[model samples]
Target: MHCIGNGGFFMWWWIASAAALAVLIVVVLLSSVRVRLKYYREGENDEVDASLSALFGLVRLRYKVPTVELKPWLNGIRMKVAPEETSGVLPELDFAREEIRRFVQRVRKLIAHMKNYKRFFADTLKHVHVVELRWDTRFGLTDAAETGMTGGVVWGLKSALLGVASRWMSFERLPSVTVTPVFNQPTFRTEIVIRTRMKVFRIIAIGAMLVYRVLKRRGGWIVWLRVLLGRSPKESTA
Candidate 1:
């Protein structure tokens, strides 16, 4: 009887542990994820910073482009990537072109595996909330008239972008925007920051559904296997 009692205790312990684990998973999936972006440009210096954090920073990713003002015509563009206090430089234009090509190819592959990518992207992004947005720019030209004209154009562009962005996302707060025209000396500077938040569960759910649909397609698994093996779509075995 004692042995049976101990067996029952162990079984209950296992059941309780499983229940606790399921609760924890639900909490994590429901947690909020934050995305941030900062772009700065002053004179010839420009840089972009981006980060993502979730569960009070337990899960985080930091990405930055140290110098975005590379002169492609003078000495070829240089891209500085720094992560974990380490930096690597690559030719900016060439690297960007290759990445864009791969991205396009990936989109095409996804379309072949799971048709209707437009719907997924639109649906997923629509749920993303713009929690904060701030943009400030200062510009100047030797001529006052030119400076005024440019400032108006900049303001117009900012308004147009905000209008479009608002249609796609729910803005938690009105964007703080400013544009100053300095006519004394010829100079220009701008800074833009945006913060977004979304529920981790929704994103994961959508992505999982997309993956499930893709894997259900004919030979879809083989398509990704080739990609994993570093073989382009053109490569085939008889």
Candidate 2:
């Protein structure tokens, strides 16, 4: 009878220890974690001005078992722009066209970089656990002049796993922008907000770790194969 009792106690002790360890890991990850960014620029002669700000972090933790609940959010991304003073309608039209061209070029560059980075980080990214994300964003433009213009856009994404192994995971961005000449002063404004809840499963985490090991070794071979096939070496193997 005593031996049976001791065995039962041992089982309970093991369970308790595991629970404690899990809690400790979560606490460590949550401590001292914060991300923020802000920027502003104004021309010396008040001809042009712009500003932006953003923040991301955990807001709450509800539970941790079967799945861990994390309230992660990103918000307060705002921007504004004002046109420079110029004489003649032709000059204003030219300035607007130039600004539109520059904006398109920047977007193209950003997309290209994102694609390259995703390919470069493929191997390492595969090991990241799945997450449920709730994202939201808003964009707006305002104009109060001879050629007034105004518009706003909102976007949202939910419950996504990020990695090549997860064939369903995907991200896309489509932007529609236009510029027109203004007889008077011109102005533009935009705002974005995002909220998310992430849950990680033990099985998925374990699988990710195992996959990472294999990917670390297979990465070189994959690159070589792509080269032999006349494909870009940076292409994602997964």
Candidate 3:
């Protein structure tokens, strides 16, 4: 009778452990999910505010990016996550803070690169004034012709800017990010926020479709078999 009791207890323990593990996995996956985004623009300036929530709103992240002077002029990023939200999932607060710092550094580097590119382009155009003048004289263009040429140049520039904007707006580096815990009593909520210009969900969908197509064409069964065997397809069969 004691042996049977012991067996039942062990079985219940195993079931309980599996249940807890499943719940933990679900919480972790949902905790940093992008939930909402709000965008506002005032003349040449724009701002984007986004929120990320986890565990059915038990954990939340909020961030704001205020583009003060426009494209290249970022007014710095402000992000905060509540401390209560970091209880079980996050191991340490220091690690989370360091991660946020690294992200800010990356943003600064990108901004600097953009500013340098703008300066270089402006200088190049200044140097080309003589060439532009020569072209104008050689063409003997009328006012209407000059206006058309200017319009074409402006259209090309607008298209190039749009292309760059589309690529930059895709948050390829960090899709969902968890912020460090802010210990203030009034604001003790774990937050994970992601603000992006382009529709990242759509991009992901398109990428997944492309990957599926490639895998299907290359024999999806072989790929699945290799994944189950814990071996890359490029590895030798031997």
> Which sequence of candidate numbers ranks them by lDDT, best first?
1, 3, 2
Which pairs clash in the backbone of model 2? none
Q: Is 1 or 2 the stronger prediction by TM-score?
A: 1
Q: Write the per-residue lDDT of candidate 2 for residues 98-137, one digit (tens) a residue.
A: 4445556544433333323354345334433323222222
Off by over 4 Å in 3: 1-4, 30-32, 35-39, 44-48, 63-238
Residue pairs with clashing backbones, model 1: none
| RMSD in angstroms between candidate 3 and the native structure over all alpha carbons | 20.6
Question: Which stretches of model 2 miss by more than 4 angstroms?
Answer: 1-12, 15-146, 149-184, 202-238
Model 3 clashing residue pairs (backbone): 31-54, 60-191, 61-191, 61-192, 82-189, 82-190
TM-score, candidate number 1: 0.81
* Model 3 whole-model lDDT (C-alpha atoms): 0.41
Question: lDDT of each prediction vs. the true structure?
Answer: 0.80, 0.35, 0.41
| Cα RMSD to the true fold for all candidates | 3.9, 16.7, 20.6
Tens-digit lDDT track of model 1 for 149-221: 9899999999999999888888999999999999868998999999999988988888797787667777777
lDDT of 3 at 4: 55
